[model samples]
Target: MDAASWDERYRGAELVWTAGPNRFVEEELAGLPVGRAVDLGAGEGRNALWLAERGWEVDAVDFSAVALDKAGRLAAERGVGLLRTVCADLTGWSAPEAPYDLALIAYLHLPWPQMAQVLRRAASAVRPGGTLLLVGHDAANLEHGHGGPQDPRVLYTAEQIAELWRPYADVLRAEAVTRPVTDADGSHAAVVVLVRAVRK
Candidate 1:
């Protein structure tokens, strides 16, 4: 979907995504010391706000201005002041002025080539010894996982993520990690593939 579509989607009565941060983000970033961070495609600023609460200065970038506005309100309500929201297309958006201590690209789906370019740019924005983390729907998610984008072209594998960031950063961790998803029927299933790498 384009920016207009996403804007329209977020202009509705409710937030499309949950208020909390992504589970992978919480787990992966829990141990890191707070520093400069960038959240690409930060829908509603969940992860970005969470990071801010933890003392990180966060830049939350998304295409939807309405989403950013809601994110700002959410941040104010939560009493976290470290969030800076930017409305721009990730495909053409410029990187932050300074090198970030951490860069997060969570669940931002795009075509394969564009995804690679975005990942590469995100990785390059990280400072040396910093981290560039990516979490998204696994390619297998469409067939086996519970919820995410249905399009296979935007879904990714651990190998693909590794290759995308290889030129700019060292692969610290690149594998498919699963998390449980609870259903209304009381059954449980796994969803999402988490890929994490640190800048060399």
Candidate 2:
């Protein structure tokens, strides 16, 4: 969807997504050292707020100002105040001035070319030895997962992600992981792929 579309969607009171960090984000980053981090397409700042609570200074970027406002309020209500919110389109946005220890891009669906470009830029934002983590609806999500963007052009595979990051980083892990996803009917189904890499 375009920025205008997303803005209107988030302008409503439905809470576009759950108010919790993705399970893969929690699992992969749990034991890592806290440091400067960035959450791209950080809708509602779930991952960003979670990182701040864990002692990481976070920069949360999204195109929708409405979502950022909601995220800011959520951070304040949680009593953890380390998040910096930025409203910008990822396709044209630049990274933070300083290198980050970790960069997270979770469920930020975009066209294949755009996704490749953005992921490459995100990889560059990490410092040497820093980590770059990505978790999103795998291409299989359309067939096996219950919820996510219906367009396959935005969905990715492990192989595609590996190619996206291979030029600038060493992929520490690139694999398709099955995680349980509950449908509107409350039926459980498997969804998502989790890919991670460390700056070289």
Best by lDDT: 2
**Tens-digit lDDT track for model 2 on 16-114?**
888888889999999999999999999889999999999999999999988998899999999988999999999998886799999999989999998
Query: Model 1 TM-score?
Result: 0.94
After TM-score superposition, what is the CA distance of residue 51 in candidate 1 from its true location, in Å? 0.2
| Residue-wise C-alpha lDDT for candidate 1, range 13-131, written one tens digit per residue | 67888899888899889999999999999989989999999999999999999899999999999898899999989998778678999999998999999988888889888999999
- Each model's backbone clash number: 0, 0
Report lDDT (Cα) of residue 131, candidate 1: 91
Q: What's the TM-score of every candidate structure? A: 0.94, 0.95
Q: RMSD for each model, in Å, please? A: 1.5, 1.3
The global Cα lDDT (0 to 1) of model 1 is: 0.88
Candidate 2 whole-model C-alpha lDDT, 0 to 1 = 0.89
Locate the minimum summed-lDDT window of 10 residues in model 2. Answer: 181-190
lDDT of 1 at 49: 93
